[model samples]
Target: MVKVLLLITSAVLIILSLLQSGKSEGFTGAFSGSKGLDLFSNSKERGAEKVISNLTLVTGVLYFALVIIAILGQ
Candidate 1:
């Protein structure tokens, strides 16, 4: 039930985090002050990156909340 959901949420968070590009130059393939250009190419790619970052943050929060709930339930 709750535990299963929590596990799934955690897995999703992990995957999302992995899928996201890192802030460092090595990961993004461009150094700082490049104006957010690299593999992203254009505004659409940047927007998609933002969306994924937001979703990763949200899912991370959810995962933490679920862990607390599971602990408190015990």
Candidate 2:
């Protein structure tokens, strides 16, 4: 049961992470400095973006907790 939950949680985490928008323009613009140091700029996450971001965060925490529980149960 623990293993199944772990797998599901991990899968959800991965999916949520992928669904999020990229903060930067990848290595090309950031390293090239072509975007004028806007890599860490304040890009507001609203609507679906905000929801997905929050879900990703929550799922990450849940996944970590599940991993610890599994380890301790062994």
Candidate 3:
């Protein structure tokens, strides 16, 4: 039960975190003609990025809490 929820949350966090774009470090975009982009320019994540990011953070916190509880309970 709780373990299932923990695994699901972990998977969701991993997926959501992967959906985010990296900062590019000012090199990839500079030479790849990918400027003026919110991750690649021309298109955005439709605001779901924030939601997913927040949820990922929350899930991460919950995962840690669950781990602590399980460890302490044993």
Q: Indicate which candidate wins on TM-score.
A: 2
Query: On residues 25-55, what C-alpha lDDT tens digit does candidate 3 reach at each position?
Result: 4666667776533554544444777677677
Show where candidate 3 strays beyond 4 Å: 26-46
Error of 2 at 46 (Å): 0.6
> Rank order by TM-score, top first?
2, 1, 3
Q: Evaluate all candidate structures by whole-model CA lDDT and list the values in order.
A: 0.80, 0.87, 0.73
In model 1, the clashing pairs are none
The numbered model that scores best in lDDT is 2
Clashes of 3: 1
Name the 10 consecutive residues with the lowest summed lDDT in model 2: 33-42
Better of 1 and 3 by TM-score: 1
> For residues 2-72, what per-residue lDDT tens digits would candidate 1 score against the true structure?
89999899899989989987554563545556544455454334687988989998998999999999999
**What are the clash counts of all predictions, listed in order?**
0, 0, 1
Give TM per candidate: 0.70, 0.82, 0.59
Preferred candidate (lDDT higher): 1 or 3: 1
Q: Across residues 1-74, which tens digit of lDDT does each residue of candidate 2 receive?
A: 98999999999988998898777677787678676457467878899999999998898898899999999999
**Residue 13 of model 2: what lDDT?**
89
Let me know the TM-score candidate 1 reaches against the reference structure: 0.70
To one decimal, what is the Cα RMSD in angstroms of model 1 from the true structure? 5.8
